[model samples]
Target: MVAASGADARKTIHPLFIRVTHWVNAFAIFVMVLSGWRIYNASPPFGFEFPAGFTLGGWLAGALAWHFAAMWLLALNGFAYLAYGLVSGHFRRSFLPISLRGALHDVLVACRGQLDHAPGRYNAAQRLLYIGVILAVIIAILSGLAIWKPVQLQALTALMGGYETARRVHFFAMAAIVAFLIVHIGLAVSVKGMLAPMFTGRAEAPR
Candidate 1:
């Protein structure tokens, strides 16, 4: 009984590699977003520019450099995370068996201000949201590549419906990611002890 209790008391919510990759991906995404905004401000996408204060790099040339640098980091780290998740079965264990009905139920529960705080499993809503974010990141990367090297990556640009369409897709993908981040941060703050696991790799024992 004592041994069982000890095991239960020290649950591992995330492994070391996952934690490291997660933080690195976060930093890369942040740099890309800010620098991308700066680059976009140099040429408005839809006849409107993002505010200068909200952007990075301070100039078009500097912003382009920062964006490309961060893009490589984001690609490498993102793919590493994906490969690890697949090979380790982390994705299957954490996000598999998701269904529309289950997600709807979780959404209703969340609406009622009830959230499952189980340390060993993610709720359906989390699984769905996480998967959605992953797809969005893939879209952003593809579209970005199309825009970055339209002449060299002509086939990719055409696949994305040409350079202009790819740019639009990239912009919308970034917007979706930003929206997800806002919700993610809000949920983290609302849930007690939610943020600690990402840092310490262990969640508080389920109540």
Candidate 2:
């Protein structure tokens, strides 16, 4: 943990893999949000539509491209992290914690805005969030594909309650992921500045 001369005060900010894939995920999320909005505009929801001057072609076509492209970025960054975590042994030490009861307790605290006492490298609440996001991403991809090619995926679409129903589910899943991201960032700032550890790979407490 030796710091470079003159840069002694500033710690190492992120291992190479972490830093790279993190930014990549951030960028891809941004693109997904932007393109997703455009796609939404074509079909409008809740009686709101994309402005008249703005059009991202027909709804399905635009959404399909943007969604799949963003999916690749998310998947790439995710798998990279997976490999790194396993190889570096961080997955077990820093990521895995046996505390289902404690986790549930932490969730209650988080709901009350009392994150100061949350435990573990990621806290129970944070762990739940990360896990939820991963699941949501998978769900969104599957639901999206069902919607995109209902005819080809007729079985899946049927399982989802039909083509239009699958599309609705996909849209809802995207919204849920976005909501989770917002809350995640907010929670990070709430507790010990979470970004620093992601950047520096070190926190006040050992992983």
Candidate 3:
């Protein structure tokens, strides 16, 4: 454990590997999102294009390179993160045993701005959201593979309801991830000292 000062004491809440993978995954996702937007602009998936200025990669070819590079990074880093989480018992320790009743209660408490913030334990709402985001990421990756190699991965594309449907699913998964990122950043910034763990591998514990 680590320590801070006053009522906002801190402890070594995050391990070194967790910290590394968290930042790596974050960067990978960031690059993937921006470059993906540029790539999408080429085909206009929904008949509308993302603003070029707000996207990364100058053009189609550039975007494809960036997107593919980031995709591999995301996959490798995510796999490592998941493996470590499981092997280290982090997933069970932090997110398991979530009951529906407990989750609902926690959600209501969160709505009232009263969720607990104990060290080393995730609240029900956080556990649920985190799990949901993980599932979304898996969906995004699968759908992306279907879109990227429809011929080679015909089974996957067919499973996802064909090429166009897989494209739409990938888009929606990306949208969900973006939405989760917005909410995650908002919540982290809104709380004092909440961002320290990912950066310093520690967090302020309550007195």
Ordered by lDDT, highest first, the candidates read 1, 3, 2
lDDT by residue (tens digit), candidate 3, 1-207: 334454345567888998899999999999999999998898886878898998989999998999998999999999999999999999999889877788889889988988876756788878888888898999999999999999999999999999999999999999999999998999888877778877887666553
What TM-scores do the predictions have? 0.93, 0.70, 0.91
lDDT of 2 by residue, 1-207 (tens): 443333444444356687778788878777666666677776765577655334333466776587677778877787887789789976666556747787799888878877574333467656667767767877777786787788988998898889878877877888888899888777668666466667665443422
Native-vs-model 1 lDDT? 0.90
Best by TM-score: 1
Worst lDDT run of 10 residues, candidate 3, spans 1-10
By lDDT, the better pick of 1 and 3 is 1
Model 1 stretches astray by more than 4 angstroms: 1-8
Which is better, 2 or 3, measured by TM-score? 3
lDDT of 2 at 133: 79
Error of 1 at 102 (Å): 1.4
C-alpha local distance difference test of each model: 0.90, 0.70, 0.88
As a TM-score, model 3 comes out at 0.91
lDDT by residue for model 1 (39-153), tens:
8887887888888898889899998999999888999999999999999999999999888799899989989988666875889988998999999999999999999899999
Q: Model 2 segments beyond 4 Å from truth? A: 1-15, 49-68, 83-92, 95-100, 110-120, 204-207
